[model samples]
Target: MDLECSDLFEWHMQSGHGKVYADSFALFISIPLASLCVLILIS
Candidate 1:
């Protein structure tokens, strides 16, 4: 049971990191697109 818990914790940590990275990448892409949209609207 201890080993299982440890494995689960490690998996969760890895998945959490991946989720954070994906969120960051999405935000990075979105900022440029958002700026472009704002510019278009202004024009």
Candidate 2:
């Protein structure tokens, strides 16, 4: 029972880590694109 719980916790942590990494990557891509769009609009 304890082992099963630990495994589940680890799995959840891994999934959460993946989500966080993907979110940051998306933010990085979006921020640059947004900045470029804003610059184009100003120009």
Candidate 3:
């Protein structure tokens, strides 16, 4: 039972990390795209 609980905890932690990584990647991509759009509008 304890081992199962630990495994579940680890799985949740990994999933949380994945979500954070994906969010960071999306933000990185969006910031560059937004900057490009702004530059195009200015020019």
Candidate 4:
């Protein structure tokens, strides 16, 4: 199981999907946090 997980991870990094997913994930998380920060500053 561990080996399979590592293999998949390597494939993702090599294929460039890893970077895309990471960027999207960062945006997904940051957007909500940013909005919350704005709301706090306004209030």
Candidate 5:
């Protein structure tokens, strides 16, 4: 199990840093919209 996990992790790390930027962009946009919806519901 440990070996499998390590292999998977290595494969993921090799995939490149582009995914990190894309994920961060999605998170940045989603967090504010999610918070706004929550605030509207509370009000």
Candidate 6:
């Protein structure tokens, strides 16, 4: 997961549109993932 994130970051840094897409994409993915983690911990 970390490696994938790093790769995405590197790819995004190489392009303007990719950077915007990556930032929003990361936010979208991370919110759901973080909520899942919290739910697991609460359970």
- Show pairs that collide, candidate 3: none
- Per TM-score, the best of the predicted structures is 4
Query: Using Cα atoms with residue i matched to residue i, what is each candidate's TM-score against the true structure?
Result: 0.61, 0.62, 0.62, 0.67, 0.58, 0.62
Q: For model 1, what is the alpha-carbon lDDT of residue 2?
A: 100
Off by more than 4 A, model 1: 1-14
Each model's backbone clash number: 0, 0, 0, 0, 0, 0
Shift in Å, residue 38, candidate 4: 0.2
Once all C-alphas are superposed, what RMSD does model 1 give against the true structure?
Answer: 8.7
| 1 or 5, greater by lDDT | 5
Per-residue lDDT over 16-36 for candidate 2, one digit per residue giving the tens place of the 0 to 100 score: 586776678889999999999
lDDT of 4 by residue, 1-43 (tens): 9999999877887886898976888899999999999999999
Worst window of 10 by summed lDDT in candidate 2: 9-18
The 10 consecutive residues of candidate 5 with the worst lDDT sum are 9-18
Q: Which 10 consecutive positions of candidate 4 have the poorest summed lDDT?
A: 8-17
- Tell me the alpha-carbon RMSD of every candidate: 8.7, 9.1, 9.2, 3.0, 5.3, 4.9
Model 6, 1-43: lDDT tens digits are: 9999899878878987887887899999999999999999999
Per-residue lDDT of model 5, residues 1-43, tens digit only: 9999888767766789757856888899999999999999999
Number of the top lDDT candidate? 6
- List, residue by residue over 1-43, the lDDT tens digit for candidate 1: 9999888766855885867766788899999999999999999
Residue 36 of model 5: what lDDT? 100
Question: What are the lDDT figures for the candidates, one per model?
Answer: 0.84, 0.83, 0.84, 0.90, 0.84, 0.90
Clashing pairs in 5: none
Instruction: Name the regions of candidate 3 deviating beyond 4 angstroms.
Output: 1-14
Off-target runs (Cα >4 Å) in candidate 5 are: 1-15
